[model samples]
Target chain A: MAIQREHELHSRRRGRNVAMGLILGGLVAMIFAVSIVKLSQSQSEDSTAPNYVPATAGASE
Target chain B: MADVSSIDTREYEAQFGDYVELLKPRVMRLVVFTALVGMLVAPVPVHPVIAFASILCIAIGAGASGALNMWWDRDIDAIMKRTMGRPIPSGRVQPGEALAIGLALSGLSVMLLAVFANLAAAGWLAFTIFFYVVVYSIGLKRRTPQNIVIGGAAGAFPPLLGWVVATGSISVEPVLLVALILIWTPPHFWALALWRNEDYKAAGIPMLPVARGERVTRRYIFGYTLLLIPVALAPSFTQIGGIAYFAVSLVLNVVLLAGAWRLLKRQESDRDADNFRAEKQFFGFTIVYLFVHFVMLLVEATLRAFDLSITALPIWF
Candidate 1:
């Protein structure tokens, strides 16, 4: 009976750990997802093409 | 979490090394570098002695923030392996002592800046410390994952403060510099968080990687890096930087984006190999990238004073 009780306690502890891990993991994941979406949307609106200007007066305008 | 009552009184020791560690010297170095850049790049010239004094006060203010952060986060620091050896956690310095030192230094730094430099610079420095300690460390760090993103503004203030010290007023140029640092902070810190997620997890801190999976963190990292390229290039569109700055920024941004993309592409199993390398390279290159960009700005400003037009880049994006 004692041995069975010990095994049950161990399983309960394991279950708690997994639950905590998943909760924390999910929270972190959500943060990253939101930040990425926000950033990417902002990027899409801003053009990536470079507009180079001449460095000197002699260079073609 | 261990109760404060459970801590052994006999274990606490206020040692010299403990006080030094409380300062977060590593972070202070970056603050000093960025502040120096701001001072150097300003349009108005400051005397060498005053510049040195201003930077010193800024460094002290940064250290004060570090000490306060360490004092407040002692509970979580004890749990996180990465921060386990911190002065408070290791019992080398009592928490109260750390708090005292931080608060004292914060006041000293601001007072000295105001007396020796200008009130404007001192006011900004005080605000930065308050923002870091109260706003970011206490209010934001644990409660939200957007902590670093928002908290990044505190770190971004040094350069602007430095510029104000030289010019005695705020301007568009300093604002652009602050914006660049503000945007850069998210990806830089998040990259570190990705590799150290486990530490954050064990400590119960909700860092992006700890709450989010690695894949999502990688994508976020890439997106931020992509955004940073244009932000870094913004100075080129101002009176501050010329052709030299633009050329360096363009090349550096391309390299940084490629590195970020490579990091995003790696699988979990291969993270330690490819992704780690990419992160390290991008991190290292970022230091040089900012340094070169600022140096070019200083050079361009110097050339302009001599009536030599190296380049007259547009003043807006």
Candidate 2:
């Protein structure tokens, strides 16, 4: 009975660890995705459309 | 302290599993699910990482409350046949150990949420844990016939906490969500209490059915079910829910009210011969009732987000 209980305990702990690991892994992946989305939006704005034109270009003048 | 050399390491390690069991994972699932829905339907979007961490914290806080409840109620748990197999009651874990783990996890979850989310959400989470452990479990549970009626607030906080995590502010919509849970709780729990009256009696706990008699309890259940209908429908009038949710809530509430009526009309013989099948079915449907409401709200939110909502009622309506 003691040995059986020990085995069950070990199994439960292993299951817990696996579940926790999956949750942590998913959180990391989501954060990475959000970062990519934010970065691309910033990059698109900076590269495609400048907020200001150069004085020499005379667009503003 | 006992000698380290004399301690049995293998037995000590096995006890760790029992500590997890004390957290009441089944209850934690509901806490997480409802909290997730709360986050999903909030007016402002939460960052994915913050949402994930906050929900995790909410679940941990819920588990912490469960552990603390178990720590406090080990004696009664041992007496009740339904709870006799719990970790502390079964001797798989010690009372002091449960208390320590509960306190530790309570602080950890609160601190983690404060760091990952806003202080308001974390503070609400802390209050929820305290309410469950101190106000409900220790104070009122064994003392009053209205224990579940008052104690149910602790169970209903996850959605409000989730909403706060997302928006850092309260609104009538989330307050209505909390109100829906508050009204729905009595009938949901009373149905279980109807069948489990024996367990409460054996444990010397003052549950409604045991204290006020089944007839009165059934009447209250029917009364609360009737009250829940208007509250559940009110959200659709607000911006939180739309046509799909309105239809769903109407149907679910009707079914649950029918069940409550049946439970109220059940003969004593029906309760005895069939073992309160009406009560049990009402309990089962109540779970479905609550879950489906949130799921429909989530669906409405998702649809509105994509500007594909065909089921949104006119704002004036």
Runs in model 1 deviating more than 4 A are A1-61, B1-13, B272-275, B302-309
Docking class of 2: incorrect
Interface RMSD of 1: 19.5
TM-score of chain B of 1: 0.90
Error of 2 at B103 (Å): 0.4
Indicate which candidate wins on TM-score.
2
Model 2 C-alpha lDDT per residue in residues B1-317, reported as the tens digit of each score: 43334544445343345667899999999999999999899887876756787898899999999999999999999998889999988888878888998998999889878766678899999999999889999999999998987788899899999999988877888888888888889999889988888999999999999999999999999999888899899888777788889998989988988888898898899989987877888899999999999999899899889987775476532
Query: Candidate 1, residues B135-182: lDDT per residue as tens digits?
Result: 999999998887898789998998898888887788888898888888
lDDT of 1: 0.78
lDDT of 2 at B15: 38
Pairs with steric clashes in candidate 1: A28-B211, A28-B212, A29-B211, A29-B212
Cα-based lDDT for every prediction: 0.78, 0.83
Query: Where does candidate 2 chain B have its weakest 10-residue lDDT segment?
Result: B1-10
True contacts kept of 1: 0.00
